[model samples]
Target: MTGVTQQAKSSKDRILEAAVAMTGENLGAGLSVRAVAARAGVSTGSLRHHFPTQRALQEAVLTAIYDLVIPDDHVIHDTSLPARDRLIACLRLVLAPAAPGKPSREAWSTVYERFIAPEPTEELRATYLATAREGLRRVEYWLSVLVEEGALAAGDNTRRARFLNTVVGGLSVERAMPGEASVLEAETEVLGMAVDAVLASREPGE
Candidate 1:
């Protein structure tokens, strides 16, 4: 690659890395252009050149996060594993950032403070929606892979993905709250049930 192109790519990478770090720290609330530029050690003009709008920057950062956060393609693609087991493993990956007890509670508290407790600004609302959309998209992608393997019946997986996401979301909340001592076992059972529903689902005509 030419020197100038290489330099531009490096600058963009730095900006994206900074934004992802800030999002992890503050849950997308402090992702202002100035703050991201400062964290990236790039001038505001440079940041803007790479990402023209705050929404654009936020979306790009979120895409990068999906890449970083969900690298479980191995689990999804391992055909030897039971289809239900693979799906459950993929869903479990979503809960890694918020394990049970104090850490999980703290993660939920952050969500409450940023998006729920306050009347969110337009930008915050957009960010949260983008996050939810990306999550559903990710689950859909996992289901598609299983369908390709003939492990899951082929159909439009939008509804299936939503159901699985709801189950995972509820599990996350359960982890944050006081729960029975058999939390892990119960979690596994719930996930299996969710996976079974998706796997057994048939299209309306069928």
Candidate 2:
């Protein structure tokens, strides 16, 4: 029983990893069960045993990507660091270049591309919206903490959180789009301005 359980876990992990790789290669393409099975070095039958269906596999892969992009260990609430600095660190983590061989940027690009599609399949749409909401929830939580810490004003934290999230999302889109050097530079400057504006809005007492 233990051996079987271990093997099943390993197989599932392989499927998730392969799905991420395929998503990275083509942000707009849907991952087929056969392609994922092939990448995982397993037969379709074996893959089905773990995932049941393509939707199940896709959701699992999407959830796995979310975990990687915002790992639990990330400092979402570090009171020692000023709120602005902590927020900046959070932004940097999301925007930083992927590790040498990892496909972090590509995975993020794929997620955003899927989220903004005009009409995704029901399952895909649900997955994208859920992922976006989860991100927003986390940002809101952190923003509230900052407000409680007196780093920000007592005004509407919800609106502020949404604004910051929108800015970040827009910047991510710009970075992913085909662009010339000037365009990329403009996107970077815009992100900087967004952050500066947020920081500048702090109350005098804060």
Candidate 3:
């Protein structure tokens, strides 16, 4: 029984990995079960064994992507750092590339573009929104913690989370456009301005 459980878990992981890879290539389209199964080198029956419906598979994919893009490590909950600093750290992690090059940035832009599209099926929309809501929830959760720590004011954390998400969404769209080095710099500058504006909006003396 234990072995069966481990095998099932491994299969689920493979399906999710395959979905991520496929989504990277075709972000705007829904990934087919057969395609994902093929990518994972598993039979369709095997894929269905783990995810009975396309919605299930797609939700799993979004969940996996969200986990990779915004892992727990990105949310700083340290009590030592001032609330403002922690908020900045969280914003930087959400906006800036995790490395020197902008591969992660490009990848995330692709994901965001997919999210904003109208072609996705209802299942996809539900899955996408749920994943996005979870991401916002994490931001709000951290912000609330900071508020309790006397770092942020006692205001609407929900609205603040939505605002931050909008900022990231707009930045991702700008970054997704085809541009030269100068254009990249402009995009970066715009993102910096957005972050600065949000940080500046914090109330006096929290």
Best by lDDT: 1
Q: What's model 3's TM-score?
A: 0.59
Residue 135, candidate 1: Cα error in Å is 1.0
TM-score of each: 0.88, 0.54, 0.59
For lDDT, candidate 1 versus 3, the one ahead is 1
* Candidate 1, lDDT over the whole model: 0.88
lDDT digits (tens) for residues 1-206 of candidate 3: 34544246577778888888997676566778888998887889989999998767776776677667766443566657665566666765665554323664666656667776457778567656766776787778767776776655677778878887887666555555554547546655665665455545565566
Could you tell me which residue pairs clash in candidate 2? none
Residue ranges of candidate 2 with Cα displaced over 4 Å: 1-65, 72-74, 97-118, 177-189, 199-206
> How large is the C-alpha RMSD of every model relative to the true structure?
3.5, 7.1, 6.0
Inter-residue clash pairs, candidate 1: none
Residue-by-residue lDDT tens digits, candidate 1, 1-206: 54654246588999998899899887847588998888878899999999998878887988899878888789888888898999899999998878888989988988888899888788778989989988998999999998988888988799999999999999999998898867878899999999998999989999
lDDT of each: 0.88, 0.67, 0.68
Off by over 4 Å in 3: 1-9, 43-49, 72-75, 98-131, 144-156, 171-206
- Residues 69-173, candidate 2: write the lDDT tens digits: 765334657666666667766765656544212344575555656666457777566656655666676666667776777776666556666788898776665
Which stretches of model 1 miss by more than 4 angstroms?
A: 1-9, 28-30, 43-45
Cand. 3 Cα-lDDT: 0.68
Top TM-score prediction, candidate number: 1
